[model samples]
Target: MILAVDIGTSSMKGGLITKEGYLFSYHRVRFPLESLKGDFSFSTELWSQGFLEILETLGASKVSVVAISGNGPTMVAANAQGKPLSPALMWNSDLGDSSIHSSSYYLSKINWLRENEPQLYEKSDLFLSCPEILYTQLTGRSVMVAPQEGYIPYIWSDSELERFHFRKSAFPEIVHMGSVVAPVSENAFLKTSLKPGIPVVACGSDFIASLIGSGAMKPGRICDRAGTSEGINYCASAAIGDSRVRELPHAVKGLVNISAILSSTGSLFEWYRQLTGQEKNNYKETMDGVNAVPASQGHPFFFPSMKGENLWEFKKGLFSGLEPGQGKFELGRSVMEAIGFAVRRSLEIFEELDLPVHELRVSGGQAKSPVWNQMKADITGKTMLIPEIEDAELLGCACLAATALGIYNSVSEASEDLVKIKHEIHPRKEFSDIYDIKYRRYRRACESVVSFYRDYPVSE
Candidate 1:
């Protein structure tokens, strides 16, 4: 059996999988509220606790290999012994630059530490990403996991390191995903109850793992890994150099992953529910209210963002076409519609770039909502594929472990063997036609916001 784990922002989820891809058991552990600080920082100890707790819940004797994935480019300054010197610098932490085009921004976190917490910075032996820190703790080896050579620039290029004036020694040796890092150390075994000889396989960032787990390994397949934020990962054969989309190497070698992120898909729904004083209402009730409001040409429209050409130029959300009788239900429907429209716009950008989206493999919390799933299908005019394992991140780790252990020839092959489609939602022509017109209006309203913002540019 393989022990697969994915470390998330607020929580960690893990599961056990057999060599044949059967999931034995799964568990999740969340960081205590007290450990998570308001400044987008959290104690790294929470990760160790979560790992041990998961192991406690799922006994480790039968586990042959361990594969772990985590969120990044979150940086953790650690000592020579793989002990954290301070709280982790989260992915959302302000590191002076908000750009994701390069890894210089992530290095800025280390710079911030040097300037603010000079003592800890000087004491640190290396700065590691979220998952690498945990791997170091388990295997007593400090290394970085870069999905491919192209991704090295997005992590730490030699030029970026020189430009930032940081010593290369502060960084770990770069390793590709699925490489056996090392055997679990005796110390880790004593602390976590696992044997010391288990091989620890590298599973890159959570998003990459989700891409593999969702079976988005082939060109034209897109993975909609939705959570608080949504990532539309479109796998392609060639890398695209476009500002509208970010391109990186796919988990499967020789493939490209062109992606865009909607920063507030699921979170926006929750935000609207809270703002409308429906906080007490359950998710089903809120979505039910949204479903009751019929989708029509006259339905209220909403624009959840006012982003311009620049990714950082996000302003206030706009709610257009509100009427006298319209209340929470209308507004709620508009929110859902806005989310759908946002997804369509992203796909349109991909289409323009010649990366045609064949279908969407939907995963995450929003995948549970059939109403939203159907709305996404109708709005995007693409099929929605719900995988048997909705938590594809954990499954992705399983794929990595399976590949590392020679259970499969490669991660893509492992994914093909393991991932099974549970349901498929096709677009309804009636709703698609209505949404096609609504989508045009949504674009126009977004253009209006851009023009308005240009005339009266926002102040930072």
Candidate 2:
């Protein structure tokens, strides 16, 4: 059996998969994020504890392999021994930005790093995402960041190591995604009540894994990942040479993945919940109320830039179109509509790149809401499909591990063997027309706000 784990910003998920791609057992646990004046952070100890606890629950009987996937671009300062030097700077953490001008500005931030953290940056032997770091601590071996696990130590040729200014000794020997890292350490087994020598593989990033899990491997396919933030990722054989479209590192060689992310989605809803104190049985109840409201037609258009707009230089969040008599439901619907419209804007850019969007695979916590999924489908004018397994990220990691262990010939083959589509949500012509109008308004609001900021800057 192979163990697959997804370590996300808010939670950690684990699953036990058979060699044939069937999942046998699964577990999940939530962890808190520490927010201090908008600088988000997570305790490394908390992460470690969550993993250990999950392993203890799995009890190590039927598990033979382990694979890991995690949130990306999360910066961690690790010591020479591969231990964390400080709390993980989460992907959402804005504290690392050197200045307000640097926030949400990727190139400027990179330049800032070169100037400010030059020494630490130069000595940065290994700059890995959360999953890589976690796997390193578990296995006591180094693996170069690559798509396939088999290509690890051999792929990181001496030249490649030097190019990254990394020492051969400091780098972890690469193990394929399903390859066994080591016998669970004797000490670890004793503490966690698990047998040792379980094979651990290098699963890729959470988004990539989720896409695979959602069965969105073919070109022209798209997946809308609506979590705290919304990320619209589509598979394309051709490269999109736009700064807005982030070209993600692929586990597979010679293949590229492109994504356009809207930094706020469900987060806006959460903010509304906090402000209104609307009591609901759960997220479903909250969304049902939102679904009852009509498509908004008024001022108070939200910028949906809670984390700053990804494709622009703006850094501040904005809200417009506030008026009396606007109840919580309108406010909630507007936030939902704003997010859907943001996604529509991203699709417009994708269309401009001439990328074909054949279908959209929707997943994540927010996908549970028919309202949100329908809203997204209407706004993008594409059919949205949900997979039988909602936790595509976890399944994607497992599939990678299975392929790495030679259980499957390739990642695509494994994805086909495992992932199953559960439902389809098609766009309604009427709703699509409504969304067209709202989307135009959304753009106008965005442009107007950006113009206002440019002409009349806000005091920092």
Candidate 3:
């Protein structure tokens, strides 16, 4: 059996799986990451605790190798003894004053620690991204991810490291995502009953896992991993020179990964669910509410802004053009439309770059909603491919694990065998113009108020 763990944004999930890709038992555990909302600070301790909890709860056994993946572009400072120096600055942390983008940059956080906690920084052993931290925690070895393996910090050259006034020595020994770092050590055994010296396969970002799992390695394909946050990625045969989307080198050599993130899509929906209690814990009623009603027809336009960055300003989400006596259902429909509009916005940007989206492979929270999936298809006017597996990212990690154990000839083969498609969603031609107009209105609404927020970004 193989153990695959995904350290997600809000939770950690893992399971025991047969080498042939059959999941024996699955489990998930959500950590209290919101304890520090200011910087999204989370206890590094919860990572291991959560992993062990999953292992014990599932009663997993015979784990030949473990492949772990997590959120990245996040910064974790470690001391000489491989201890975390501070609470991890999560992927969405907004504490950066240099620039909003700088906040997510690993190097920037290193400098911040050097200034703010110089004493700890002095004793710090190395800095790591989220995935590497988890891998090192189990393997009892500190290392940096090879540039080609992860999404962020694409710069690993000596000259580039020097440019930041950071020495390459301050980082872990570079390792590729699929290679074995080492067997689990005695330290890992102290927490769990798993035997020591089992090869620990390296994994990269959540996006990395999903891309391989979605089978979006081909050119002109797109993977819409719409989870807690929405990441729309386009796999291209060559590097796209457009600045509209951030690019990562794909797992398949020479494939350029073009992607964009909607900071508050699914999260905004969860927020609304908690506020309205329309359907209680799940989104069935909310999605049903959206489909049961016609388009708002410009009555309500939602910004869907929750800590939006890289824009001219920072603004919270709002429902504009609300009328008197608008019920919770109306607000719910508007929010759904708002999220669909956000997807359209990302598709439009990708279109502008001439890498028109041929098909959108949708995963995560939105895939559970056929209504929401169809709405995205209609709004974006693109075919939507939904995977049979909800945990594409975890399955992707499984693919990496299997490859490391030589279960498959290559990553491509592992994905082809493991990642299966459930169905495809097509646009409703009848609703195209309705969404077309609403998307235009959504854009105009954003333009009208963004400048105000830009000038006065202070939160009230």
Per-residue lDDT tens digits for candidate 3, residues 1-460, read 7788888777787877676666678888876636425373678777778888987887646677888888866778876445677888777776443631331356666667776777766777778877777677777787655425444345244555566666566776767777787888877523567778788888767778888878887888888997668888898887777776777788887788888877667667767776787525556767776677776343566665533433211146667889987777778888877777777778888888888776888777678789888888888888999886667777788888888888888888898888778898898888877788777766766776576677877467
TM-score top scorer = 1
Cα TM-score per model: 0.90, 0.83, 0.88
Tens digits of lDDT, candidate 2, 69-131: 887656565554457655565667664544323212222223334466666556655544577
Tell me the TM-score of model 3. Answer: 0.88
Better of 2 and 3 by TM-score: 3
Q: In order, what lDDT does every prediction score? A: 0.82, 0.67, 0.73
- Candidate 1 per-residue lDDT over residues 129-236, each given as its tens digit: 888988888988889897767677677877777776677888888898887999999975226778898999999789999998899988889999987578899989
Ranking by TM-score: 1, 3, 2
Question: Least lDDT summed over 10 consecutive residues: which range in candidate 2?
Answer: 102-111
The top-ranked prediction according to lDDT is 1
The lDDT ranking, best first, is: 1, 3, 2
Model 2 gets an lDDT of 0.67
